[model samples]
Target: MTEPTRLGGFLRKSGAFLVVGGAAFVVDAVAFNLLAFGIDGHGPLYDMPLVAKVIAIVVATVVTYVGNRYWTFGTRALQRKFSRYVIFVALNIAAIGIQLGCLAFSRYVLGFEGILADNIAGTFIGQALATAFRFVTYDRWVFPDDHESSARTAIESA
Candidate 1:
């Protein structure tokens, strides 16, 4: 492919990844808020922010795995890629650790607490860093497509 064609293909695939990631982000944010704050009373089990972050991350990981497998990466052979998917899940757990560490640092070390601090630490800072890690890993490890040129071809022809 030409340089321009390759660039366009990369952008198109990136756009797809962003769309899937954005949807998962919404799910994570909403679930985190509900779990951390509750509706009209104290939140459910584990009022702690880290616990809430864990729950939110679990929920969002499911959404992200499914979206990334089917939509973003287009890996339809679940049986074949099950082990790779597990590795992907493991990486996400590490990403959650990064997020939780940020939240903990802000809340404990920095002596800041509550919703805003948690959001700033976990959502913006941690997630941004984790996102770069995820994109690289998802491309290089999890979705190891043998016919990667097919995806590029479709995008380039569009």
Candidate 2:
């Protein structure tokens, strides 16, 4: 068996990340639209778009964490579960800020508060920026590669 080249490994990791992110994005989009726009343009949090975004982000964060942990970066290492979760949440909060900023810009700065505008600004543009940020930060900090240590730790535990 041969190890993959650097670019190959990166492509593989990024492909998995994209798959996980796409699923999480769906979750976020559905939750946000439901809360902010509702069935017929009047959701429970229609007046509170930011709050709606926060709620949606929370839900989507959970999904992304699980997917990334168990699938995207699963084989790296499984150390410091609680601390990793904390870091993950913190990074996600920063991502949420990115999303909220986009939404706010559309609603306040640009004065385009329609559903289409909100989706384009927050769900699409904001998500793209945040996703890129997450991929970099998560790879560098949250899920550092420690394959040898992880295997040794597993053997020791067993």
Candidate 3:
């Protein structure tokens, strides 16, 4: 019997997703910092955190979504159902909440300190958690085109 291809494909997809996400995160973080400091010119508590965060999330999400859709899952998943992308967007909204909550908590309660530092630290922690959630949801629901189950069923029946 041939080995399952899903495992290999999943690993490759997830790895690419991670790499793209890393780049996106850096881009968003830098933009957030620049806007918060250069444009508004305020510290962490001066009422610019949310704005910066929103921008960061938007920028990063766009990159993450495109990369995941194209490189991770490939075009096959896209050809399946268009509504799936909508569902994926909804799930990302939840992830945004998680990311924001962590950032706020670390900044307010833990006194994470500094605009850049607080955002960086909080987002790192938050995004880590959120990414895990995204993986499961995407694997089971979002893409839903791995075709691993039927292959197993056929193998077993044979």
**Who wins the TM-score comparison?**
2
Q: Estimate, for each residue in 26-124, the C-alpha lDDT of model 3 and write its tens digit.
A: 876776677666556663524667667777788888888778777776744334677887898899889888888887787777776566566665567
Candidate 3 Cα outliers beyond 4 Å, as residue runs = 1-6, 39-46, 80-82, 146-158
Assess every candidate by TM-score. Answer: 0.83, 0.88, 0.77
TM-score of predicted model 1? 0.83
- Once fitted onto the true fold, the runs of candidate 2 whose alpha carbons sit more than 4 angstroms away are 1-4, 148-158
- Using TM-score as the yardstick, the better of models 2 and 3 is 2
Estimate, for each residue in 37-57, the C-alpha lDDT of model 1 and write its tens digit: 677535673358888888888
Q: lDDT (CA) for every model shown?
A: 0.78, 0.90, 0.73
Ranking by TM-score: 2, 1, 3
Which lDDT value does model 3 have at 53?
A: 75
User: For candidate 3, what is the TM-score?
Assistant: 0.77
